[model samples]
Target: MQATNTLPLDMVYHWEATKADSLYLTQPVGNDQVVEYTWGRAVDEARRMASYLKSLNLPEKSRIGLISKNCAHWIMTDWTIWMAGHISVPLYPTLNAETVNYILNHAECDVLFVGKLDDWEMMKPGVPDSVRCISFPLSPPNDFETWDDIIARCSPLEENVQREPEELATIVYTSGSTGKPKGVMLTFLNMAYAAEGGMEVLKVGSDERMLSYLPLAHVFERTFVELASLYAGFHLFFAESLDTFVEDMQRAQPTLFLSVPRLWVKFQQGVLQKLPQKKLDTLLKIPVVNKLIKKKILKGLGLDKVKLAGSGSAPLAGDVLDWYRNLGLELLEGYGMSENFAYSHINKPGRSRTGYVGENMPGVETKISPEGEILIKSPATMLGYYKDEEKTKETFTEDGFLKTGDVGEIDEAGRLRITGRMKEIFKTSKGKYIAPAPIENQLMANQSIEQVCVSGANQTQPFALVQLAEGVRDKVADEAYRKELETTFSQLVDRVNKTVDPHEQLAFIVVMSDEWTIENNFLTPTLKLKRNVVEDTYEGKINDWYAQRKKVIWQ
Candidate 1:
């Protein structure tokens, strides 16, 4: 459980010595093509990239921008930036031109590495002419140097390059859910401490396998996928695209799987499509039949081999956790933020609390403020917000605890149940305050609901704006499906309302056909809903929604 007090590049060197011939990265190319990189080859390629970057003759500690989906080249680019003594600035692939431009200019990025974009045309306008651009494998059309060409032309770095543990490593930007994304400056020590603390609790091995599909720009994926892999020597697999996700998972048979709650709900819905919930529940009651059912279900979802599965980046409903546990898959819930490198708390395996994120991680300290905000002090805490001293000072306590902004309380056992965001609690016209997260979590138990936002500021009672799960639209035209949905949702709302305070009961459920996506700005890169944006977009229609006599109104 001792921390690896070495830099990321130093850990890479350790892996090169211990696991030279082992596979480090697996990237899928075409339908039948895949590219594999051994530890030695990966290091060599990274060294070549470092050489090329060094050739640019940029100032020491210059910022380098990386924009791409999760892929092998993305990790390679990060290693190259670190080895070349530069700071990495990652951009979400789904970012708009304006946001991308803002991050690059604000960071004063001297060079950019572009890789595998969904829409290059949309992002092209944001690239400043002053900054040089380089392209990675499978890059889009652009007047920039290619990754392959650089590797072929540049000589590999001959000697080892090291960084101090306290030196600046990367600048991670927040998801911009509340406002403009602010740059968070994280040092090598911060990232190393987080990786070490997480691994100490998780106890992963070199043989552990993982799939990389989440946005690497987010601290969650970067910590688990990139930093953890370096610290633990785990083999990382990259999904080809959305189309091949299941196949990729099946191929990797990952031992550790991590995902957001949205995808977990989708997986449950997919199983429900094949076998109705009632039938599955009945079969699960029988001992022998239950084992077979769980096996088949897990295999179908490509999670049969996953010994550790987790849900994070948002609150997971108790029902969802129970559903997975019923099928013999223990879904651990975790809580953290970008400011802390996601090294706060995680439910330990075989001892998970159903409704709470587990104990504070090793070497991390946590306490609740008088205002009920969760404050954490850890070695993994970011140094400060880049070039924003005022905002940085506002985010931390005078005593040095990082203010998490989440309102939560710790139980007697030290488990944490996140109630809601401090700023998200809405006051109704009836002078009652409502916490929307718990209500939203309860509503999400209904299979028909994909996402929900509860709002009623200045209203008598709060109501829910709901988005239906995928494929629900195609089935809506069928009379039976429509009736079944209406019946289920009606019963669900009634059941949930009876469990909550009367003032907190939802007035009506506004079912909307529109989808919330990262591309559309409704969801952040981490799949968290932008509540302020959702409320702003639907504020004008709340009056009509409230006037409807029916409990469920479709928009």
Candidate 2:
């Protein structure tokens, strides 16, 4: 596989030189409204933005913040920042004012770019007076300069701005589930290495279509939609909103799809709602009916055209993977972190294990440390944490391997199965240690469960606090619904307990009626459960749950 040597700006020039008239981005603003950009147009617009950014006369390598949902302007701004010799700082659109303030101050962003957002009033207080504000389409409330106005006012930059591989590209803040977010400094070389390695494994072509809905603030989406698209020259499509996700997917008919485990589980539940699990199972056992059923299922979900589907950011349940595989979509699981540009381990097309995140990618090395932590050495490894030299030094080993903080064992075939996070494993009062991730994975297999956290800080045994699925919560007070839930949860707990050690058996399963959402601070922007938050919220209620006689308790 050939490695990428040129910087992203050069890649843009390459695409423009080769495929000038080809469609590059499609952004939907309304039901029937879409703005399309060819590779040539996108380059011209980015150059115009770059010209304007240069006219500001900001210091070289100045940190520029971008706050927006996924859109063409977001990518264009990123390219513009890089081309103008500045570092990009992307903030999550759903972030609160305090966090936004923290990130902006921490990164010392000189210029802030605002795009399509939900609440500008809530975020306005965070924007410091020192930083210059620039607005993209669907302008935010303020005295910021608009994107169209800037492009119209400035001429296209004619002089090519050259960048080295080791030059700083972006500062991506980790979406920390437990503590304050830290900035991960990534270079052009790091991103390019990741894109080259991933493209080698996936072999995506220019014709490949991808839906860009995930937060580009995260490395996962940024790597695929922004970085890899530049390398692979694939067409990118943006989702209008959550309400039109299905319609967007159908219109894009993406050849490659990547999503988190939570969405994959929701897809499973969506299918089960139409075809009950029992009936679907029975039908799958039949000869020709199974084929037709699989087609209908995938077509309904707009995934029938997907050649490669992947789940990451969180561990996916084996049952959910099997469910999709049965429908003829190999839902491969990959593993990586922000520090590595998410270019570590990925399951290959025809060679994937059920419960493991597959082997290391090209030019990557992985091993389990003596302390059972997964360590990685790769070209894509980040330079360091942005502002904290202490934390950065602490994250890597003396021998240069990045300590992943995940406890895992490598199989004989080199596949890695994550056991638990080192900080997340809790010990019972009886001196028994429990790994919650495996249990949580098993519990999530139950159709009624949406999210769960297992903890027993000083108790004799661990118990689970579960958030019921959305559909189940709709009929909460109905006697029939409650009875059905209790029965199913009881069975699930019993089955899980039987599979684990006696000391690790759950004492009770407490189901919560409320939903866990990013807006509520229960989940990260990437849809990963905030276990620390969940445990803290339900810690006081656990004793009462355990005191109840029933094995399943509803809160």
TM-score versus the correct structure, for each prediction? 0.98, 0.98
Model 1: per-residue lDDT, tens digit, 5-104?
7778889889888888999999988776889999998998999999988988999999999999888999988989999999999999989999989999
lDDT of 2 by residue, 148-253 (tens): 8889888999877888889999999999998889999999999989988888889888889999999999999999778888999999999998889999999899
Summed backbone clashes in each candidate are 0, 0
Candidate 1 local accuracy as lDDT?
0.90
* RMSD to the hidden true structure, all candidates: 1.3, 1.2
lDDT of 2 at 117: 91
Badly placed stretches (over 4 Å) of model 2 are 1-4
Give me the runs in candidate 1 sitting further than 4 Å from their true place: 1-4
- Model 1 compared with the native: what TM-score? 0.98
